[model samples]
Target chain A: NAGVTQTPKFRILKIGQSMTLQCAQDMNHNYMYWYRQDPGMGLKLIYYSVGAGITDKGEVPNGYNVSRSTTEDFPLRLELAAPSQTSVYFCASRLGQGARNTEAFFGQGTRLTVV
Target chain B: AQSVSQHNHHVILSEAASLELGCNYSYGGTVNLFWYVQYPGQHLQLLLKYFSGDPLVKGIKGFEAEFIKSKFSFNLRKPSVQWSDTAEYFCAQGAGSYQLTFGKGTKLSVIP
Candidate 1:
């Protein structure tokens, strides 16, 4: 299985531009998450979904929106790109709730540049 | 709110040197701890994890971590290091629920 797949490995956006970071998982996981990693900083949670059509904001949900349309997809939207929005984005999935029986699988990541 | 902290922002080691990276979390309830490694130009992958049972958990690439309840720490260690081990390491904590909080990653550089 491809596990978690993220589209557009790399993208550059101008100020005021918007784009969507697409994420898909083939494992049928119930939990999906979007996170961004800035230089020298830890990954910050942008948004998460427990299941299809159910999404929640995380610690760093500002400047972003997420939609979980189907069980396999959860896409993150940057309505207006800013310089601070430049970072490496990752999408992860977990098969179970919080149990150690399942660990989250991460996508390769999308490197975004906001100029 | 739950959060994770990694003391070291960067660590440099020589080949065959023993390595340790400190990770701590703030949460009153039971939790699961994990260590993930991201190699250059690669995705973040699980290095090891601790859920229940033994406090000492072994993971791939000859890595291990000990979960000390009293210290509130899950420290990753390797008896010996290899140049290939150079990568960015992240410590993440998950509480009663599946949502996880990650610390600022530690960049480990094993110099040959």
Candidate 2:
């Protein structure tokens, strides 16, 4: 299974630039998430979607926006990039069951650099 | 939201030596704990998981994690290390919500 897929393996952005990180899943999962991993800081949640048309902010949502227009796509947008926003971004998806969720499948992260 | 903490940022050990990585989690209600490993230049993969039963969970590649609910700890252990086991390990926590929180990963380097 192709699980989760993320586009633009690497990118460079100038300050104040904008870009979008695209994520797609083939497992028909109901939950999708975006996270950024900084050195020694682990992965912090930027946004997540429980299902189509339902999205919510995560731990570190600043400068990021996400939309879940379809079950397979959850794209994260950077309206205005900053140096602090440079990090490896990961997209994950999980099977949405009852009140609890299941294990997630991760994508090959996208490395972003803002200068 | 739940949060995860990993105690070690970096660890180096000789091959065949024992290994242990510490992780702690916090949540108000029931939580699902997991350990994810990322090899160099690869995506993260599930190492082990703990949900309802068996606090001691065994995983692939001879990895095991013990979940101490009373102490809010889940530590990963391996009896013997190999150079192939060198990687970055992340501890994660998932609650009733759709989100999963990860800890600052521990990078392990096993000398051959």
Candidate 3:
């Protein structure tokens, strides 16, 4: 089962360019999240969705947007990419709340570079 | 705002040495703690988690953590280490909120 899948394992974008990072989960989970990992800085949340048609901004939401139109897909949009936006992005899904058994499953991650 | 803290940025140990990585969180309410490991070229995976019950929770790869409520600490430990144990470790906390606050992470390097 492809628990969580993130498309375009690697990508490069020029400054001021825009692109979308696609994420999908097959587990039918209610919660999905987008996070970026920078050197020495663990993971910073970008956006999240509690369920279909519901989304919310996370800790680090600047320069990004997200939409949850279906239960399986939650995509993050980068508007006018900047050098600071160059980081490894990860998508995760959880079955429910912060219960012990509801630990999140993460995708392989997409390494994005903005020049 | 709640936040997680991992004190060790980098740790190096020879094989079979005892290991301990400190983690602390700044949330007082009902909290759920977790430890995640990321091997080289791989996605983050759950190493262990604690919701309730015993403070000393054991997880995969002979790793375990102890939750000290008074100190707001959940420290990961292993009796012995192997070269394969080298990886980056993260500590995260989920409180009354839906999202988790992750620490900066600790990189463990176990040399043979």
Candidate 4:
């Protein structure tokens, strides 16, 4: 099974443009997350969903929105792309909640460049 | 603000050398610590994690980390390094449910 699948591995958007980063997981995980990775900055959580139709903001939720329409899908939307939004986006999913989450399975990542 | 801090931004080492990467978190309550590694052109993967139980936690690939609450530290260690160990390591805390706060990653380059 494709653990976590992220679409448009690479994308370029102009300032003020909008786009969505698609994420789907076949693992049937109830927990899905969107994170952005920047050089030397590590990965910052952008948004997360514990289950379908339930989403929450994370530490770096600014400039992004997420909708969990289904348990297998949680897409991150960039409403108005800016140069500062350029970063590698990753989608991850884990099976459980609480501290017992075995581990999060990550996608290959989508490299987005906003000019 | 809650933060996870990695002391070193980068580290270089020769094969067979020992390794230790320091990490600290700002939150004081129950903490879930994790170390994730990203190899060249790859997605991040879990190296190990500590939610509770023993202070010392062993992970995949002969890697381990010790959680010292007194110091707010969860340092990753490896007895010997290999060229294949070259990767970027991130120290993160699973804060407030499943939300993760990560420190600036430490790039580790192991020379053969």
In candidate 2, what are the lDDT values of residues B9-106, reduced to their tens digit? 99999999999999999885888988999999888999988888989999999999999989999999999999999999999999876768899999
Local accuracy by lDDT, each model? 0.92, 0.92, 0.93, 0.91
Which portions of model 2 miss their true places by more than 4 Å?
A99-101
Among these predicted structures, which one has the highest DockQ? Answer: 2
Off by over 4 Å in 1: A98-101
Off by over 4 Å in 3: A97-101
Residue B60 in candidate 1, Cα distance off native in Å: 0.5
Can you give the DockQ of every candidate in the order shown?
0.71, 0.76, 0.64, 0.62
TM-score of each: 0.97, 0.96, 0.97, 0.93
Better of 2 and 4 by TM-score: 2
TM-score-wise, the better of 1 and 4 is 1
Report RMSD for candidate 4. Answer: 1.6
- For model 1, the docking class works out as medium
Q: In candidate 1, what are the lDDT values of residues B40-76, reduced to their tens digit?
A: 9888999998888999999998999999999999999
DockQ-wise, the better of 1 and 4 is 1
Which rank order by DockQ, best down to worst? 2, 1, 3, 4
Clashing pairs in 2: none
lDDT of 3 by residue, A1-115 (tens): 9899999899999999999999999998988999999999999999988889999999999999999999999999999999999999999998864343468899999999999
Ranking by lDDT: 3, 1, 2, 4
Query: Scoring model 2 with DockQ, what do you get?
Result: 0.76
